[model samples]
Target: MNIRNEWVSFKIGDIYFPDPQQVAFERHKDDLLDGKVADLSDHGLLKEVFAVVEVEGIEQPVIVPVDRLSGPAPEMSAGEE
Candidate 1:
């Protein structure tokens, strides 16, 4: 079994939290911007925003920003320098 560490806060390696206020922006948004907030989820954009993965040495799954993840290296073919 893989061992993992228990996180007490958002200060874990490469893991952080968005502004608390932003989390409930719908509640703190300006009246003028009412109904103007773009719902990225509507376009299925939310799926690419974050990735949940089990990292080695981590006790629990981590939610990391998708953009921060590096793509796998391209495979080299025979005779390819």
Candidate 2:
């Protein structure tokens, strides 16, 4: 699948994951934007989008949430903090 707009960066939350899982994501950083939307789930007001990406050392493509892929960075203000 082709995505019209590629993400500028990827930012995974500071969460724990198995060593293998972590490595998979890191290895596919460059191709993350090429991932395809394999599935989507409806959650009332929100819809969850999942992407299928191939990672090094992993035989099967991994599925991850679209939100994990960063878009335009949000602007912050000094007073907000």
Candidate 3:
């Protein structure tokens, strides 16, 4: 799987969020929520996300999973092109 760094909209569970940064923010606010943030850096398969989101109460990047994301298929990989 090839992962590309691009802006994408993703949905975690039933709630649709706009971007990875927002996903991180929501996860920070809710501890009981079970969801993952889409990893734009990788493709083909969902994986853990390692992004740094600047939240008002948190001082670190939130690490979430990728399986919770459901959205339009990612752009074709270099080899696919």
Candidate 4:
């Protein structure tokens, strides 16, 4: 999942997951956090979480699904001129 240049960001409905239990039950990691698309998949968009940590001695990017995402995709900010 090389998402270095294919990242997208959006927002999800506030009521999508109203309880912590729902988040825990989900297998994907990104679905449990804020709305930031990291990778696009056949199933859905991958939510991105910026964190610096090692999991089981392997450094990995945290990405989930956009199942709960709502509305249109967010506008991309302008880069430095």
Q: Residue-wise lDDT of candidate 3 within 1-55, one digit each (tens)?
A: 5558867664564455466667667777654432223334455343554422233
lDDT of 4 at 45: 26
Show the lowest summed lDDT stretch of 10 residues, model 4: 49-58
Q: Model 4 reaches what TM-score against the true structure?
A: 0.21
lDDT of 1 by residue, 1-81 (tens): 554785454422333466555555654454221011122322436546765555445466665555554533243223444
Worst 10 residues of 1 by lDDT: 31-40
lDDT of 1: 0.44
Q: What value does the lDDT take at residue 51 in candidate 2?
A: 54
Encode model 4's per-residue lDDT on 1-81: one tens digit a residue: 778988775344343555655654564555323333444555342354333222233346444334544433234323412
10 residues in a row with least lDDT, candidate 3 = 72-81
* Ordered list by TM-score, greatest first: 1, 2, 3, 4
TM-scores of the models, in the order given: 0.30, 0.30, 0.25, 0.21
Model 4 stretches astray by more than 4 angstroms: 1-32, 43-59, 70-81
> Total clashing residue pairs per candidate?
2, 0, 2, 0
Off by over 4 Å in 3: 1-39, 43-54, 69-81
Give the candidate number with the greatest lDDT.
2
lDDT assessment of candidate 4: 0.42
